[model samples]
Target: MTNVREAALDVIEKINKNQAYSNLLLNETINKHKLIRKDIGLLTEIVYGTIQRQKTLDFYLDDFLTNRKKIQPWVISLLHLSLYQMIYLDRVPDRAVIHEAVEIAKKRGHKGITGMVNGVLRNVQRKGLKDFSSISDSAERVSIEKSHPLWLVKRWIEQFGLAETEAMCEENLQAPYVTARVNTMKTTVEQVLHELSEAGLDVIKGDLSEDAIKVIQGHLIETDVYKSGEVTIQDESSMLVARALDVESGQAILDACAAPGGKTTHIAERLQGEGYVQSLDLHEHKIKLIKKQAERLGLTNVEAMALDSRLVTDKFEENSFDRVLVDAPCTGFGVLRRKPDIKWSKKPEDVERITSVQWGILDSQASLVKPGGKLVYSTCTIEEAENQEIVAAFLKDHPEFSMDNTMIERLPNGVEPYVDGGELQLLPHYFGTDGFYIATLIKDS
Candidate 1:
C-alpha cells in the first residue's frame, strides 16, 4: 500500500509540476521502482482513474472544504487520488481507501495536515457528491459530471448536441480495447488468429477491418506473430486510412504525415511490394521510426525521409503521385479514451492554431496529387472546426477536388452508422473505436 500510494503521488506531482504525460510517467515510474505486478496494477488504476476523474473528485471535495482551507498541492492530490478510489472503484472498500489516504498523509505531511485529510475523506464517505442540479447551466453540470473541461463541453454541445456530447464524455472515461492490424501481406487474419490461439492468447477479429484483430488480453509484441511482423498493434479506426486511399498495385503513393509508421506501413502492405510510397515526416527521428517499421514488416516499397508535408510543393513536383494522404495534426480531443490528459492539456485556442496548420498542409499537398488522382485527408479528431469544417473550407477554394462518393461503398459494413455521406466521423461512443475523421477527395482530370 505504501509503495503504491507513494508511486502514484510521485507520478501525480510530476504530471502537475513538470507537465509530464500521465501514461509515459506511469510506465517509467513503475519500472524505475521495480514494483510487483499487483502493486503496478493498483498504481496504474489510481493514477489514471484519479486523473480521469480529477474535476468531479474536486467538485465532491469542495463541499468538505467548508472553511476555505488552503490545502497544499500534495495534500489536495492525495485527497483527489483517494476520493477517485472511493467514488469510482466499487471493488475497493471505502474504509481501506480512507485509511490508506490518511496513512499517506501522515507519511508525507505533518500532524495538522494529516488530521485535515482524515476529516475530509471521512465526510466524503458519509455523503457522496450532492445533486449537481445546483450547477444551473446544462453544459457546466455535464462537464463536472463527466470530468471534462467546461469550455470543451460547451463547444461540444454546440457541435454534437446534448445527448451525444454527454455520451462521448462518458465514453472517454472507459478503458479502450487493444487493437492490432494483421500484416495481410505476410499472412491472413485467419492464420494469425489460429497462431495466436495456439500461443494461448485471447484474440478476436476486429469489427470493421478484415485485417485488424482485437486483443482481448496479453501483450502482442511478446507473441511470435508480432515479433515476426505478422501483426502490428494499431487501432481499428486507423486501419481505415490506407483503405480509404484505395491504393492499387504499382501506384505511387505519398503519406504526407507518416510517422511512427502505422498507416505508412499499412499503405506499403496494401501496395503488395509494388510501386513506391514516399513516407514523409517533419523530423529525422520520426523518419527513422518509419524506416524501422518498414524494415520490421519486411516491406521494400516504402522510402522514409524527413520532408515536411506542409512544404510538399517545394520538395516534390506538382502532380507527382497517384495518391496522397494527409493524416493531419489535430487537438486530439477524439482520442480521449487512449489519452485522457489531452482534455486538460489542450485549450480552445489550440483548435484554431491546429486548424490553420491542417489547412496549410492540405493546401500544399493538394498540389502534389496528379490530375485524376485521389487525396485522402484524415485526422483522429471529432471537432467540427478541425474535421468537417477544415475540408469544407479547403474545398471552397479548390473546386478541382470533389468528395469521393465511392467512400461510402469503400467502408466496411457496420461502419455505415457512423459514415456521413462520403466522409465519416467515427465517434467513440457510437462505434466503440477511436474517434477518427476520414474524407476521401478526387481531383478532376
Candidate 2:
C-alpha cells in the first residue's frame, strides 16, 4: 500500500519547491503512487486544502511558532498538511493526524525537528490560534480569513466592494461541482441526464445553460456516457461562449487562441457540421488537443492549426469569417476554486501584461469579422482591465463595430440582467459559475 501521508508530504514539498501546479501535481502523484480511490481522496484533500488555506494556516502556525526562521521548507509543508486535516477534515481523528505528522517528520528529519513539529501542533490545539476576529483592518482580516493573498484581496476590494470581494474569496475556497455540456448534436440534454442517472451516477440538470448537466457523483470523465461522447466536461460559464457567438449553419467562424477547444467544438456543434471553425493556437501540441476534442465529439467542421492569434491577418484574408472568438488568457483568478495554485502563481503585474495581449488579440481578430457579422471577446477572469477596459479601448479605435445588444437575447435567459452595454462579467458568488467576462461587438454593413 502507498503511504498516503508520505505521498501528501511529497506532493506538498514538490509544489512549494518546484512551483508546480497543485491540481496537476496531485493527480500525477496519485497516479505514480498508484493510490486507491480512498487514498486519492485523502491526498487531494490534504494538498488542495492546504493550498487553499495556506494564508490562514500560516496565520495559526505563526501564533504558536516561536521561531519561524529555523523551519525548513519541507517541514512547513508537513505542518500545513497536518493542520489542514486537523482543522478542515472532521472525520479524520485529531490524534491520528498529529501522530502521522510526527512519523513523517521523523522519517524526513532528525528527532529534534520531529519534536518541534509535534510541539507546535499540540500547542496550537491546546492554546488555539490567535483571535483574528479582533483584527481592525477589514481587508487584512478578510485576506487572512479567506486564505487569499492580501494584494489580491485589496485589488478585488478596489474593483468590487468589500462585501462582494469577501464573498468571492470565501466562495473561491469551496469546491465547484463537476459540470458537463451535453453533445446535443447527437443527444438531447434530457436523454443524457437519463442515461447518466441510469448508469448509477447522481446528477441533475444545470440551473444555468440549456444543455449543461452537473455530476453530483462519480468521476465525470470516467463515465461511459463521456466515453461514448454524449457529454464533454466543461463549466457552464464556458458553455455560454458558443451561445454568445450564436453561430449558424454554413457560417465560417474563427477561434483565435483556441486550444483544448471547448468553445470551438461547441461552435462546430452549433454549426450542425456545416460551417468550418478555424481553431488557431500558437503551439502545435495544444492544437492537437483541439483536434482531439473535435474527434471525440465527431465534429468534422473544426480545422485545428498552429498559428499566433496576434498575426491572424497573416494567415487569412480580412473580413473573411462570419464570427470570431478571442478567449484571451488572463490570470485565471475566476477559476481559483478548481485550481487554487493559480492564486499563488499570479502577480499584480501579470494582469497588466495579459491585458496588453488581450487588447492586441482583439484588435487583430476584429478585422476577421465580415461587414454586418459579429465578434465575441471573452476571458475567464473577473478583472475589468482584461474585460471591459479592453473592449472600451478597442471601441475607441474602431467605430465600424458597435456593441450588439441583440446578443443579450442569445445568452441564458436568467443571465440577461447582468448584461449591460452588450458585455457581461459573471462573478463566482453572484453567478454560480466561474467568474467570466463576455463582450459582443458587431461590424456595420
Candidate 3:
C-alpha cells in the first residue's frame, strides 16, 4: 500500500515550490500510487490540512527547530504533515503519526536528519502548540490563527472590519460544501433528489436556489445522475447568476469570459433549448471545456468560441443581445475554502493587477447588450475593488446603463441584505457559500 503520509508530503513539497496545484498534484499522486479509498481519504486530508494550516503549523514548529536554516526543505514539509495530523486529526494517535513521519524521514534522508525529525515530532507531542494570544496585533493574530497571509487578513479587516474579517477567515478553514445545479431541461429537482437518494447518497435541496441540491454524503460524481448529465456540480451562489440574468426563452444571450461554462449552461438550460448563448474565452483549450460541459448537460443552445472578451466587439455588433453576462475574472479570494492555496499563492499586488483586466472585460461586454436589455457583471471574489468598485466604474463610464434593482425579485428570498441597490456581494460566511459578487445592470432604451 502507498504510504499516505509520504504521498501528502510529496504533494505539499511541490505546492510550496509553486510547482503544481495542490488538488491536481494530489490527484496525480493518488492515481500513480493506486491508493485505496481509505488511503485516498487520508492523503487528501493531510495534504489539504497541512497547506490550509501551514502558517499556524510553522508558528508552532518554530519553537522546536534550534537551527532552522540547516533543516532540509523536504523535512519542513514532513514536519508540517505530521504536525497537521497530530494537532487537527483527533483520530490519529501521536505515536503512530510520529512513527510514520520518522520512517519516511529515514527513507528520504540521513541519520542526522531522521533524528531531527523524530525529536521535533516527539517535542510537539509533549509540549503541545504555541499560543496565538501572544500576538498583540489583532490583524496579525487573526492571520496566524486562521492561516491566511497577514496582508490579506489586514486588507479584509480594513474593508470588512475586524469581526467580519475574522469570521470570513475562520469560515475559509472549513471544508467547502458540495452543491450541484439540477439541469432543469433534463430533470427536475424532485426527480434528481429521488434518484440520488435511491443511490444511497445523503442529498438535500439547496437552501438558496430552487434548482440546487447539496450532497451531504457519498460521491455525487460517481453516480449515474451526475454522469448522465442530470446535474452539474456548482456552488449555490454561482447558480444565482442565470437567475439574476432573468433569462427568457427565445432571447439571445452572450456569456463573456465563459470557460468551463457553469453559468453559461445554467442560462442555456433556462432558455429551454430556444435561445442560443454565445460563450467566449481567451484560450482555445478552455473553450473546449465550455463546449464539453454544454454537451454533457445536453444543452443545444450554447455556442462557445475562443476569443478574448476585450475584442468581443470585433466579431459581434453593438446592442446585439437581449441579455449578457460578464462573469469577469478576479483574484478568487472568495473560494479559499476549496482552494486554500489561493491564500498563499495570491499577493496583494495581484488584486490591483486583476481588477484592471476585470474592468476591461466589463467594458467590452457592455456594448453587446441591446438597449433596454439586462447585463450582469459577476465575480467570485469579495474584494470591493473587484466587486462593487468595478461595477461602480462601469456604470460611471457607460451612462447609458443603470443598476437594475429588479434583480432582487428574480433572486431567492433572504438575499436582500447582501444586495445593495442592484449589486450583491455574497461573503463566504453569509450563507456558507463561496464569496461571490453579482450586479444587474440595464441598458437605457
What is the lDDT, from 0 to 100, of the residue 36 in candidate 1?
A: 85
Q: In model 1, where do residues sit more than 4 Å from their true spots?
A: 67-69
Model 3: number of clashes?
0
Q: Which candidate number has the best lDDT?
A: 3
TM-scores, each model vs. reference = 0.95, 0.98, 0.98
- lDDT of prediction 3: 0.91
RMSD of each: 1.7, 1.2, 1.2
Number of residue pairs clashing in candidate 2, backbone atoms closer than 3 angstroms, sequence gap of 3 or more or interchain: 0
Candidate 3 C-alpha lDDT tens digits along 175-283: 8769999998888999999999999999999989999999998889999999899999999999999999999999999999897899999999999889799999899
Clash totals for all models, in order?
0, 0, 0
**Residue pairs with backbone atoms closer than 3 Å in model 2 (clashes):** none
User: Can you write out model 2's per-residue Cα lDDT over 162-225, one digit (the tens) per residue?
Assistant: 9999999999999889999999989999998888888888999997888999988877787788
Task: Single out the weakest 10-residue window by summed lDDT for candidate 2.
Answer: 1-10
